[model samples]
Target: MHGLFVSDLHLLSPRSACPHIETELADYAGAHKCIVLGGDIFDFRWSDRGGHDQTLEATSRWLQDLQLATENTDIIYLPGNHDCHPDFLEQLEKLSQQSKNFSWQPHHLQLGNNLFFHGDILDAGNSLEDLQRYRRQFHHVKPQSQWAHRSYDTAVGLRVHKLVPRILHQPMRTCQRLQNAIDRLNLDDAKAVRNVFFGHTHVPIEGLKLNGRSFYNPGAGMKHMQLQPHEFTFERAIPASEIPLASDTSTKPPSK
Candidate 1:
């Protein structure tokens, strides 16, 4: 399948948006292939504070155009932490119910020789159900109080961001750290999967061989990577190049 892989767009509205990415999505949608909304496509917490549907209508129109562009393209929506909201899930469900081109899978997806996930499966060990349950269990953060969480997370995220090595920096590990604490789980079974591609932690690695398998990530807030025709070539929108070991957090090229 011709696939367009992207993650962590963290799409917001008016004040914050990724128009180029959205445009690319439209172009790829016309190809009648596949688009993987890896994770963090929506930030529900932000929606709680900033309000929802600010950009959703525009986004829906884009998706509509995409579906109209091609008769066979499949747009897969995979949930992330921010996506684990009742209303958002409901929206996706309704859209999927309306057409075959749209689909919502709670967890990871396996396509042909490649495995795709938001990466929480390996890093957090939790499933979509787990995330939703945790959200439900938590005392709801009032709109007025939401800023506290964002501010705290931002302070921590910035600190961690500065500490991460340059090569592994785009994804900023802070999100995954909080997610792991919330899920309290981990899965070491990723090694069994071949050609695994994921988007959590936002760091993108391409053709980075490990344990006889290949891994690729498009990174957070970066361009989508395309897999088509055959040979896989990554056009990184960020500088997540496989670098010489710089820190425990940074990735390394396969040893010779």
Candidate 2:
């Protein structure tokens, strides 16, 4: 089945990923039998600590609605940098267990030599090392105990509640540099991979090739440049405003 690949939805971001926009996306996704969400579908960093469950429920409503519109369609979510928090994973695991059309893959997935991931592989280190780096950049990690991680995340949650739009293009550049380094690193598994689909970069680029392999970045589903007026900032969804959901302005699917 041909799959619709989406990335960087950042559902919690006020600057992007609004109800009307996601509803439009759901309409497009309904045309596909399978849906692969590469990463950052949800930005836990923006979740209100007190109203965390309410936030998750609100973000997931559109997904649930989409599933109903396209029965039997599989929606696979791969956690990205913005959604790698332990609390988010635990909630996702529960949702996947309860929802028939939903499932979660912790790491990358391979389909006929095509790799699907959140595009974090281009980072400085392995997953653990990356986690360490994440703690430093986003959260305050303690060497004392594993419990400290959770406590610090609570603090970080309130402090860093949204993505910094100023660095929006950084991930895109990093993805490009990583593409160049792939050949330099000479990793056999990487070489064997023919098609790589990732979405850490909010920049939408399709059919980009490097080192004879096809690379695609579905870009950020939520943070579309066309929707914004000036620079991308904390712009919330204005339903009454003149916001075209899709570039083509397609009709949305029935949110049954």
The C-alpha TM-scores of every prediction are 0.62, 0.62
Per-residue alpha-carbon lDDT of model 2 for 94-183, expressed as tens digits? 666676667666655554456676766565364434533553342211222335445645544553322443265454465566566444
Worst 10 residues of 2 by lDDT: 226-235
- lDDT per residue for candidate 1 within 126-240, as digits (tens), equals 5544444444432123332556656745754565532442344333343334334323323334334456567656555665665466667765652232221112322221111
Off by over 4 Å in 2: 29-32, 48-50, 124-192, 222-256
**How high is the lDDT of residue 219 in model 2?**
56
Report the alpha-carbon TM-score of model 1 versus the true structure: 0.62
**Clash number for each model:** 2, 0
Model 1 whole-model lDDT (C-alpha atoms): 0.51
User: TM-score for model 2?
Assistant: 0.62
The local distance difference test score of each candidate is: 0.51, 0.53
